[model samples]
Target: MKNILVTGAAGFIGSNLVLELFKEGPYHIIGIDNMNDYYDVSIKEWRLEEIEKNIKKNKWTFIKGNIADKTLIEKIFEEYKPSIVVNLAAQAGVRYSITNPDAYIESNIIGFNNILEACRHSYDDGNNGVEHLIYASSSSVYGSNKKVPYSTDDKVDNPISLYAATKKSNELMAHAYSKLYNIPSTGLRFFTVYGPAGRPDMAYFGFTNKLIKGETIEIFNYGNCKRDFTYIDDIVDGIIRVIKKAPEKKIGGDGLPIPPYALYNIGNSKPENLLDFVSILQEELIRAEVLPSDYDFEAHKKLVPMQAGDVPITYADTSALERDFGFKPSTDLRTGLRKFAEWYKEFYIDGKR
Candidate 1:
């Protein structure tokens, strides 16, 4: 059985990917996470429990650790000798980067460099090493770009947020490593991903929490922003398809490797207005009985000016993804929100069993 190493295993995307991988085959999966209190430690623990509950026992292993520790990461890579490494364990959240820039630097920069270093050394002495490295790149990398349908070909030099800057740095670093080491790498720039058991810091989850408590929810930029909100299942599906293939390794005209590196945008391709997204979310919450049907959503919403490190819009050009992978994120907003609302009612409202 092939060994797959997933960093940030307890995170929203990390946990989901782990569960889905078990369904794929008898592959042995190794997962590691720091289990930080960035949002809620309980939620991360719950995700781990869910993975254990769903997957076949003995096929998977979970290690509680941080990837920023170079020694720890090197140890994991040496022991597992993973054929595929999925690095999703970065410090998330654009706003959080403003106050806590250190976290981003430590995890997003240092941690990723450690992973790349491990991958580079994996091929030492003619031993077969990590065949492909898939890491999470965020839509935030396209910060402040006025271009609609942000393409992989677009230049993303101006990052409005430190979080975005870190992600862009990841892409560049990966490309450099790929060229030098001939490591097949793919970076996925995910759009606004939302679903059940997602990050509480995300807009949808935060809005749900605030609405349930009868607190006002702020709509940034007066709800004028548009986001290509891709659902979690769709994101997982896109990732699964990506895992089966690696970029072709080839020598360039200069007799050097052309860099076996690739990047793709995973998004719904349908950018939804922020105001409309909230409306649908409210309806879903009421439908799921998380909120009363008579709940005054309008009274609970407050439009606010744009905050620091925030972009007015994020649109993705997924044509390259469709062309290569023959798939794209297609989960509609209502269906995804409904699932989240139902989950919230069960996990938070009823009882977190």
Candidate 2:
């Protein structure tokens, strides 16, 4: 069984991926996360618990550290010698990046450079190093494109936010590393991912929390937005399929190994209107008993102008993902929200496992 290293393992996508892999594993899964209080550290802690419940104690290793620490990352590579490296550790949140640009640089830029360096060195002295490197990019790199369905072929030279810029930079950095070291790498540009046990800072979760507290939920862009809200399960499914399939390696005419690099958008091709999404989330919230049946959802919803660094729509052209992986994220918004509502009720209201 291959030893796999997954950074940001306590994170939403990372934890879910780890849990799913553990279910079918004899592999040693090494997970690393700083456990920073980006939102509520408790949610991350709870995710760790969820991961623990699914794995044999000996099969999983959870390390508490930051990827920006080069020495520590090198030590992890040396000790574990992970064959597959998935770098998901990043200072996420577009708006937050405006205020905390340093965080983005530290985690997304410096941290990712370290991962690339580690992967490059893993094959030192003819040692069998990393077989494949998978990392997370974001749809924000599209940067409010007028295009209907965002395509990988679309030029992403314009990014509206620091967060988007950093993600774009990651792709460029990965490509350079791949070219220089022939590291087989795949970068996934994830759409708006939502579901149970998701980040509390995300819209769906925040809206639920606000309604529970009788606070107004802001609907940016005056409810004129559309988003391809891919569910957690769907996202994880795509990652699993991509993880096992590395891009084919090739050699140049000069006998130099060409970088095996690829990029794909992991998203539901279906884009749902913002207001319609809120309605479904509200319905699910009531159905799950997180809100009273008589709750005034309209009163609690505040439609406002779009915020800075916000986009009007995000529609993914997942044709590439489908053609390559034979998989597409098809979970409907209502169905996905229902699951999130149920899980929210269980974890937050009922405190049931």
Candidate 3:
């Protein structure tokens, strides 16, 4: 059985990915999360509870800790001896980085350095060392680029936010470690990921919450923004595929490189306008019976100027993902929103009608 360690296991994407891994068979999983109150601690706790309920065997282990602690991280790698390590624990939100820039530096930069160091030394155990190190990057790295349908080949030199800078730093750090220690690492630049149990800070979830409370939903950029929203299941599938296929060492005429590294964009490849997305979401909410059939969505939506650290549009060119994995996120906006609405109604609404 392959031993895998997943950081930020209580997070939306991380928790969903962990559950999927559990269903795949007998594999040792070391799930860790600090359970920070970035959005809501209850949500993280709830995700953990769901995972606990599904654990028929002792394959899943949960540890409440921060990824920034080098000692704790090193201990996990030493004890668990995970052959596959997935680092998804980072200060998430672009706007949050503005007021809390230090958090980004601590978690995304220093914390990731600790992870790289641990992975580097993990080879001390002759037989039990990480074969692949896959970490989460973000499409935010392409901040405000003039190009449409962002590609991995695009020069991502300009980042508009601290969050994007930290993510880009992670990729660079991973590259350095890969070259120095020969760690086979892959960085996935994820697009706007949304689904059931999504982050409350996200527009989709926030809009739903505000609409339910009869509060005006803030539509940033006067509702002109567009995003390539990728579903949670599709993101997990891409991660799993990349995990199984470690990057190969690029051999040149000079000599074999020290390490192997690769980066790919995982997205739906289709961008949808914010208004269209909200309309679909409103429809789904009504269809799921979470909202009343006569709910006035137009009255609830309030168009506003663009907020700081936000991009106007994000479209992903997933050719690399498709070419390598033969997979892409095909779930339409309505389908994904439907699942989210259904789950929200069952979990949070409590049949409130």
Tell how far residue 294 is off in model 3, in angstroms: 1.4
Minimal lDDT window, size 10, model 3 = 250-259
lDDT of 3 by residue, 1-353 (tens): 78899999999989988888888757889999989999978788888988988876549988989889999998898888899999999999999999989999989999999999999998775755689999999999999998889998999989999999999999999999998777899999999999988999999999988888999998899989999999999999899888889998676666857569999999999999999999999999999998999998778878999998899999999898899988777788899999999999997889342
Models, CA RMSD each: 1.1, 1.3, 1.6
Superior by TM-score: candidate 2 or candidate 3? 2
Error of 3 at 341 (Å): 0.8
Candidate 1 C-alpha lDDT tens digits along 1-353 = 89999999999999999999988878889999999999988889989999989877438878999888999988988888999999999999999999999999999999999999999999999989999999999999998888898999999999999999999999999999999999999999999999999999999999999999999999999999999999999999999899999999999999999999999998888899999999999999999999998999889999999999989988889999899998866677888999999999999978844
lDDT of candidate 2 vs native?
A: 0.94
Per-residue lDDT over 41-101 for candidate 2, one digit per residue giving the tens place of the 0 to 100 score: 9889999999888896439999999999999999999999999999999999999999889
Question: Which of 1 and 3 is the better model by lDDT?
Answer: 1
Candidate 1: where are CA atoms >4 Å away?
none
TM-scores for all candidates: the values are 0.98, 0.98, 0.96
Cα deviation at 8, candidate 1, in Å, is: 0.9
Candidate 2, 120: how far from true, in Å? 0.3
Which residue runs of candidate 2 sit more than 4 Å off their true CA positions?
A: none
